[model samples]
Target: MTVKGVDVASYQPTDYSTKGLDFVFIKITEGRTYTNPKWVDQRQTARDADLVTGFYHFVRPGSMTAQADYFMSRINLVKGDMLALDWEDTGVSNAEKDSFIKYVQKKRPHTRVLLYCSRDFWLNRDTTSFAGDGLWIAYHNGKPGEPGIKHPWRFHQYKTTPMDTNTGRFDDKAALREWARSKTP
Candidate 1:
């Protein structure tokens, strides 16, 4: 049992349809200064469609705590909205990624925080298996939810079929919503 999702960025349109999607993770902030110009409308698009909403930050080389603080400050976060750290920037080290996740978790107790990274980074670069709530592996193939890593992942961004499609490790939308509220892996 799984739920379909998509991770959207500024380049994506604001009136993103959520016909068959259960959740959406929109890019909120990048580094410490940049915010996704379309995030508010994208979030509203998800909200109006009644899909579970998530927000993520593109991690950069900086103080993890400060970045986490800045990310938290930018979003009007609610308890059930998922949070993620997009660790695709080559400048971001494994330690910094983990630190940012940890800092976010510490600041917002009982909140779900996830790490989004490529397969190469997870396999070759990661030193600690320290994804906060679960790892959202970004490995695109014909198959969804098959990241090819042994890490106990909870989400898989399988392809960019027009949009970044994903599969969540859950029974259904109800279960995902319950888990999102609980912030459990």
Candidate 2:
């Protein structure tokens, strides 16, 4: 069975659990400055709803270490919580992306780092330099397999209607749930 999940920012704070989502990835920070003001409440709500929770940082052009430090300082991740870097900014370089991923890994070796990028952006920007542990490919089209992505993706954001809909690569809900639970600190 495909495990359904949603990636949400401050702009989209509606309780997605009612929509039948099994997990959620919330945006915690953007660059080195902006923190989602609603993150605490949103996170609590998601947790209260028993949704497997994760956090993501929107990458911006700047010192990769600084950005990583900012993100790390803000998030309180445990084992089983997914961590991701949203690499949508075209201004960010491959080196910066690599540095960010490496810094996150060095700081939290137990946490799985996911790189979130669109298929078009990944191919156009040539983001093979990203060294995150998993991929969260965002392809708006219904089909994500046609992207020809060389990396094995764990999560695929295949739709944005109603909210961002995703499918995990796991074989069953139990397996995916086990994977999520194992990510805890």
Candidate 3:
């Protein structure tokens, strides 16, 4: 079976409920300049609720290492906490995405560093199909786990409105947690 989750950015409320979610991917940084204003409290809330927490960085035009450094230096990550690279910027190249993933992997060899992108981006822009540990695809098909693509995915953000809803490719929440800390996601 698949596990349900949500992804949130600074715009979302920190006091949101976790009644039905097994995980939460919170945007922590964008580029090297902005850090999600609500990250600390939102992350704390997820931890308090025992939801698998994930943090993502929105890529921008600049030094990949500097951005990684900026992102890594801001938060204290624990086990089962995922790290993802948001690849939506039109200016950032595919090579940069791969570089960022590689940089993060070198730093946290055991942690999962996922790639977040739309189906269009993956089909048209992607050249390497290198989504680090896994791909967190945004394909609003209403049917979760169906990204409509042959490429393997770990999480599917199958809907966006009413907040970005997702379904993970895990046997259950326990498997999700195990993959979060394991290199095999």
Q: How far out, in Å, is residue 101 in model 2?
A: 0.7
Could you give candidate 1's per-residue lDDT for residues 24-134 as a string of tens digits?
999999888999999999999999988888899998897888788888998777768989999998888877888899889888777899999989999988999899888
lDDT scores for all predictions? 0.89, 0.79, 0.92
- Runs in model 1 deviating more than 4 A are none
* TM-scores vs. true structure, each candidate: 0.96, 0.89, 0.97
lDDT of 3 at 148: 88
Question: What are the per-residue Cα lDDT tens digits for candidate 2 across 104-152?
Answer: 9888887888888888877788546464777788887876343357767
Model 1 / residue 166 / CA error / Å: 0.4
How many pairs collide in each candidate, listed in order? 0, 6, 0
lDDT of 1 at 61: 95
The lowest-lDDT stretch of 10 consecutive residues in candidate 2 is 143-152
Tell me which residue pairs clash in candidate 2.
Answer: 78-185, 79-183, 79-184, 79-185, 80-183, 80-184
Q: Rank the candidates by lDDT, best first.
A: 3, 1, 2
* Tens-digit lDDT string for candidate 3 (1-185): 99999999988999877888999999999999999999999998899989999999999988999999999998888977999999999888999999999999899887899999999999999999999999999989898988988998999999988899999999999999998877742
Best by TM-score: 3
Residue clash pairs of candidate 1: none
| Model 1 TM-score on a 0 to 1 scale | 0.96
Q: How well does candidate 2 score on lDDT at residue 23?
A: 77
